[model samples]
Target: MSEFKRAITAEDITRLQVYSDPQFTPDGDAYTYVSTAINDKNEYESHLFYKKLNGSDATPWTFGNVKNSNAQFSPDGKKVVFQSTRSGLPQLWVLNTDGGEAKQLTFFKNGAVSPAWSKDGKYIIFNASLDHDDDVESQKEQSKEERQKQNEEKKKQPLVINRLKYKSDAKGFHDNKRNQLILFDVENEKFTQLTSADTDHGYQDISPDGNFVLFTANLNDDADYELINDLFTLNLKTKDITKLTDGKGGYHSASFSPSGDKIACLGHEFAYKGATLSELYVFDIATGERTCLSEKWDMQLGDLMIGDTRLGQSTTGPVWSKEEDRLFFIATDFGATGLYQVTLNSDLEVLYKDDNHVFGFSYDPHSDSFILGISTPTNPCNFYQLRKTSELVRLTNANAKYLEEVHVEEPETLTITADDDQEIQGWLLRPYGFEEGKKYPFVLEIHGGPHAMYGQTFFHELQLLAAKGYVVLYTNPRGSHGYGQSFVDACRSDYGGGDYTDLMSAVDYVLENYSFIDENRLGVTGGSYGGFMTNWIISHTNRFKAAVTQRSISNWLSFYGVSDIGFFFTKWEHGLNLLDDPAKLWDFSPLKYAENVETPLLILHGEQDFRCPVEQGEQLFITLKHMRKQVEFVRFPGSNHELSRSGKPEMRIERLNHICRWFEEYL
Candidate 1:
């Protein structure tokens, strides 16, 4: 056995560095990525890092702890353009690889994001939200005193709500500003507005010949009532926009082939209600022939895997191979993500498979290698290199030193039989300092996104529980990704039935196989969807001694109107809207069965959480209190739905402390 170190603590999470968004230069000789670390103010700051393909040491390309991302190299590989917040607002900046400082490129009022380079390297396209009648340079010169006066006046005025989608958890309250595509000429430094529509347009890719730009937008009059985004191609010469995908489903991540003959995209037609998996599709530009390449693959063709408070977005890309006849993308399977390649003939082959989450990756056709950002159960994410010959190389060790000083447990994978005779996948994590024949209190950790999977990723909350001398177990039940569409769709409408049995079966299997787990001292906890399951578990049985639910949904009936996405999410998940069948909504609500609860429960919620509003937690607390059951509620002020993963550092630490305290008091 290795030398024993200290158990992992919540404070350790702050010291670790997160790596994401690896992109190789056009020439494939070097690559750049984003490395984020929490500053002294407890805010995340990302910097750009660069490395050469010859296995050279990595170094910071852009200094300062400011936010820098979306680094893309020009065709000649001499200049690199990226988005940065150094000037207070995020804007485009360019830096020369050989030498020189990064120069600011855009001065738009709302700033810019998702920058894409033209093939000729003379133009850079970006997305920015702007008011319909604002002049770019004129708005930039607005007096600071005048702006403050307007802000003060607006604060004193009443807030008049009119839009259907008024509030969002991530971006906050809605402004009338809409995101639109804009083109910038690198030589003249001119910003041109390409398309102006009431709806938003996101930049995707530039055609190979540099004559067309690909994007996605929803121009429907009632777009707020539906969830649909169609693909489109705009000609730069004539300024003509061509619709690619039919308005039947949602689509994103559209990429053009090298020959400009085909386009690869990732989306679904909402086939199996809200639980349908995203499938990859190929579009023939000439014939308008659309083909679903991954219709029968069963696995979700995008990154739905979640973990620690990593800063950058977790997005999947369908990059075209050098031959232009094949596409490379990532898919979730079981508890990990696998990179696969599909030929035009529909021959799918797994190129890289592992029991870890591949958060982001970039391919270099020149070297036939991939720069991968990966995370394991014991390690936070870092960069690695995978060659065509199947050779693996570790490129970055951002968390190696910290890991050496801590005791991290690698979970053991297990397969248990569900009540329906189906197989359930789970992992059992022993305490940091494990001893044979020593029984310990067990904790079953459930994941949210009954649609999302519990993967072999580094989950801090579960690790903290294990560090505190508890045997932690988590699983991907029938209603999770990576196991196929049918399994994920199975948990819908029957919230607490088969899914609950699958979890119990996992606990039973672990107790029967691992003699060190004390069956009598079992506890359970989860957040979001997991929170809902936690509530359902307590109501359905008294086997668990204690439980903690975070940002949970107690009543589907109320969730329909309260949650930001609840109106449609309720209909999509339950297959029935609130008005269509209120009784059905109540049938799955945990609040309806709170009277039967016997276990001591702890409810943790974020006050500003609109996804599963704190009201959900309040309703459950009130119900349990009315029933005279043992329950405690902890509300985090000024926090949102993503409080656990990306909330303020102090709040997250307090949350962990609350859970540990609750468990210690009861368990």
Candidate 2:
């Protein structure tokens, strides 16, 4: 280690840059990606950056504090279309690649997003929200102040509830607006409404010959109670709609082949309810036949690795080759995400596999190469070019300066056998400044999702703990993804049972093998599911000196009704609803055993969090306080369950500091 290097701090989050959505130009000469970072105002700023294939420095194409992302080049590679918030709301904007001012392309009322150019480059397809009773043409005539007045009037009236799914964590209560498709004619400079259905639609991909558009939507009458999303195609000339997938299964991330004869997607039929592993599927356009390509593969498709450092969205699902015989996609297995290739005959091959996280990638069929967005434990993100004949070439070093000044610790992987003979994977990190024989306090970090995996990604919270002189440990338990199907489904219907044992087994394994960790000075913390485990661990035993729970569920009885996904998620996970078996739900709750807690605990929650809901934290805090136990509660204003991941920048830093402060004071 160099003497000039310094330990990382919670505030260093502002200096870290995140990269995503790498796209190569049609000519394959230059590529563009989105780079995000925190500004002085404590807000996120993202911009599009462009670079050539000849090892040139990347330059920013857009300026200012506004977010610019999802850049797609035209077929001829002359112009780039992207989504931007510079117009107050997210809208479509176009910029000439040959150097000129960017032009705002859409003036829709609710804003247009996810712009995809047609094959001929004469039209652009996007999605926007529209009310059932509202006319698209009339919305353009209405001024911003007029819309504000109308919204104020609507707010004065009481909200009438009629649907089961009325609220969500991302968007609060449901409104009358339903997302619909819109087509923009570049040559005519006019807007045309494509589909005016009452249901929301997702824009997937445009056909190669420009005759059809692929989308996903549920038009069933029982859509309010159903969870299935079926793929559909809209004919441009006839304005006709055709269903592609069977109504029994849910599908998404669909894209047409080079010849437009087939469509590839990632989906499942809910074989294990919500725990089903996604499989690759191909549909014959002419015969309406769907075939499962990866039926024998037992891994989840897409980037399931969870981390707090990633900012922008990335490309997932299947990307076709020039010959159209092979397809490329990202899949999760063990603890890391890797890029893999599959053929129509069900042959699979690993294209890239390592201990790093492949968050995004852009494939160029013409050159048979890819621009990959990868992250490691020490690096937030960087772009790399991969070729069939050459080794991985580093394209952009976005965090080179930060890495040079800070010292980050790499973790040692561990495999522990559980009480049931099941193997659990974990990682251990020594304190920033450690001596060979000196003992240090240990902190056990648990990841949320009970379905998401903690892999080789840059986690700011865990790094900060290691920097604070605490030996940090994180693991993938029974319920985490990246493992096989049975492992992910093992935690369901028995929350706090096998999953709890797996975590405790990991701690025991570390303590028995690692002599430098002090057994007496131990701390634990987790968010969401991990938060639930923290509460469960402290109540079940007093081995830990301190604990912190974030956005956790303590009472399942109340959680069944309060959370946005409470009603259905309860049945899907616990295998029973509140009305089905109240006793079982209450028995699995952490609050039921709150009287046995002996360790000091800290409770943190977001006021606006609707996923787990703030009430979940409030219930546990009130119960612990009434029991005269050692507990404290901290509430973040205008935050949600994603406070640790994509919450407000300032709030995220405060959350990290609070976690470190609590552990430091007690441990």
Candidate 3:
């Protein structure tokens, strides 16, 4: 139990808050990332922490102690503009980057996000909701009052609207005014509306010349094709909005060259045909011609890399060096992470290649150098610089300082060939107390996203499980990213079919190769799609001694009716509906074989989880109880589907504890 200290305690779970979203100061000398912590008031407070590249004492900026992030220092590095919920709905706030009390920047009742600094740092341009007071329940009361005022003037009109079938995973609602672009004068504290049409203008990039702004939007266009997010340029002086990339094709990753003569943009669009791959394109601003740079390039993870399944593709942030011809960026594909430098004049060279992952790189044109954050399988994150001698310096030792008391294990990668000769790869975490010849209880962890990849990063739960003497094995199945599009789309309609086979084969490989894994005391668990797999595992066979499913889906029929993406996901993944595809969906559903579940099962859910609503867990529990199966249910009050990642700190710890306790009791 000594090593079990990494196992989250109730207090730790109760106080849990996750941090993300990193932004760098223009000079690359200082940087800031969003951190959520509990202040004296015990509220979930988020603040911006700024640290110098030279490893100086990091200072906390912003006041009132509410959640804040998406910070961008002004061009001159004098002030910072960010988003916060201090005034109810998320609004814009500006603060001095050096240190000072934060000042309110926007007062829209709807919301604002992703604040970008203007060219001269005189004004801030942000994307905000123009008018959406009528769509969501949080704003229904205000809408009712406005509707009543409208009724007083004229005849009442029926509300018949057709808009986004689903707004966003973050913001729910089909109806709302398009997210428009607005420029706010920092000096006068006034604002100038940019675009007027009912459309969304995201990625408001001010051109290098400071005379115009380049952005991507799908205004007055079909979502299917233009979803590539068409490029548009707004003249700061003339206010003339000109469409940059024309025709049916879409574009993203748009940025202006140093001289503002040429543009580097991804001219490709994504298709919903199971999997997609985006390409890099260069558009000459004056001539309006595009060239596909993805040619002769592997362009997928694992293809050009050599680390692990962390392989494939060159999806990374772009930084133009002081020399406009030289572009620096990080590239990945099915294996390892690689940093590259591309010259517009027909030459591409690899700068650095290693098993460690490199993301969020920034280059300071004045210094002719770069600074970025990176991590590997065994390393916690820190910042580094590339200079005269390839010098690497740590900026913020955020984890090691706070997590010194806990122990984390590095995962080992292995390869196993399935029955059909299919090659599969995954990481194995050994129990804390390792005895070479002694067998240990084993657990197979599955990642959700089915689309998202579980790279070589630190995961607290996996560490706790390993510390508890459980051999943890997790793999990038056919449907996981980091692989090519065909590989990821392989699990689309074959959830319980091939994907399950890949999992079972991995388990078999682990049992055969690892002498320390107990054959009799085996278990499996996962969340979301992974949760769905956990339930499927328990119902179809008694191979596992016990099981725990979090935010799971039991019946595809119910999932298609209640989940946020039910309507489309059911058809896209299962290829059927309640009536149209009832047979296939039910066949893959875990509930159909509830009577076959002989092993004890524990069900956990979050009350506010709209993705795979808690109802799914409740239904599984109820059906098992009806079938006289051994089952227990735990509900996290005020928690959401993301309990494992960003739910309450205490609740997350509690979740890890509940799963551990259940396995300890039954396995």
Candidate 4:
């Protein structure tokens, strides 16, 4: 009998399972992770899976259709506290590892998240949003439906804007609610409000002794206009707060040393604005002294690799070692994210570096092993156990059955030399069922976040393109992370100058080197920054036969006023505000060059996208249509800028089908 396999389709995204947020028990005897998948109802269902470290099969610990994530094991290893949307909104839920019914611990009106256990496991610290004038008792009295009705009434009223930052892509328009910390006493079943500031508070870590809680916030009067995250510690006993940072730099991902005498954090002082590489720092608790530990390291810290399949947060830490002499963290360098260890004395070494994406991880100091959530070009993500001397031990095979039924392609790495002798890193995936001497259409995929990197990770859209008999090429331009600070910062202020040439040079190199790619049937597509680049590429050159731009920026002048971050991002990326040089902004806009575009283009935008704003696509579509060019517009209702990554499940599938349909029509 012959084996059977089918090419991955756009609908496979629904069947794919995404694994993230791996956590290890205190004694390292067991681990738990979140597995998310789209159900038949076209809604995401995330459940917790538990597996023993003794080579046992994993089993689901939490069931049902709710989204459960951010699982943190208690210090005693008996209880697991996580955030779940079981109660209509996200709230903290506690579960027993030994098997028992889970209990809801928080009933906050606006929901609670990022739960951290105290050392003794007697309490859990979390953040919840509440209006400054609203009381917890009153909020608890209102039911979900009542709150919805109240919100509807409020929406009907006029929105009064006073702050420069009043809207966000994630949470939409701002309300009076502010994020505050809450302390939950497990035994007493009591909820105590901690911080009451009007600004939002980010809970970082709780001291080992349970006497202090480390958090980040900007309590300054000018916080609305400034972009800074200052670290502070709140004394649990006296309710006193002490500022650690000098308020000049942004700081986060802090952890207390094992002895509680020192603090480790990752932050930068805005030396190069938003492009500055985050450095590791150590703060003395007694004297309030700060020291930069990673000032000499050129790599950017944290998991900077971008992928659409990821659905949960991971530890991007300065995690303290058991002995307090060393700290382990993830850093982006050379097109990959790797685990690195840095000692208090400034000694640094790489613990794990490979051609895979380490999206999430949990370290067990007692066993000297790590539970890593790893993803490759062919795999979505799976949990693995790695020790100092041993190889990766697979803990879960969540995608094994799916992989057996699908034909996934692995990309071949390519290094292209730009016109200025600068090297650009990229990868090319041959179409499925590809044969020698046969030419196929090609699609060039660009990633968003000119500050983000597209590395060795599984991308569903890219695979679907390849499955449709099109060679796919993706590159990390000069502005992308994982390449040192200088390389990543090079695209700033000169967006269309060097970055444009680098991408074109990559196309030229691939065409010259690869014989299978059809030069005439070329397509281009991207979202966000990649969308901007796609628009720019089509207008500047008609080499591409088709182009798709999603949630893109066509005019910097309008983008400056409409986007949530447009006010400051314009000044940060372009090196000038709209008032400084309107002509320069227009010169950089792709709408200005709409008349030169000859490629058939498709504009996809989310109606509620505050990041790029739908007007961007509207302007470009209207301009191109006015010129009688081949252009189409797609507007996703109730979707935001994250439509491609974490949008509505059915809508995500629809968006994928539209991309495939457009390419099939033109390419």
Which structure among the candidates has the greatest lDDT? 2
Residue lDDT tens for model 3, 367-410: 66556556665554555666635666566665554355555677
Rank by lDDT (best first): 2, 4, 1, 3
What's the TM-score of every candidate structure?
0.97, 0.98, 0.85, 0.98
Off by over 4 Å in 4: 1-4, 137-142
* Candidate 1 local lDDT, residue 516: 93
TM-score of candidate 1 against the unseen true structure: 0.97
- Give the lDDT of residue 168 in candidate 1: 83
Quick one: how many clashes does candidate 1 have?
0
Residue-level lDDT for 404 in candidate 4:
88
Q: Candidate 3 vs. truth: CA RMSD?
A: 5.6
Per-candidate Cα lDDT values, in order, are: 0.87, 0.90, 0.71, 0.90
Model 2 lDDT per residue over 110-140, tens place: 8778999998899999888888766655556
Worst 10 residues of 2 by lDDT: 134-143
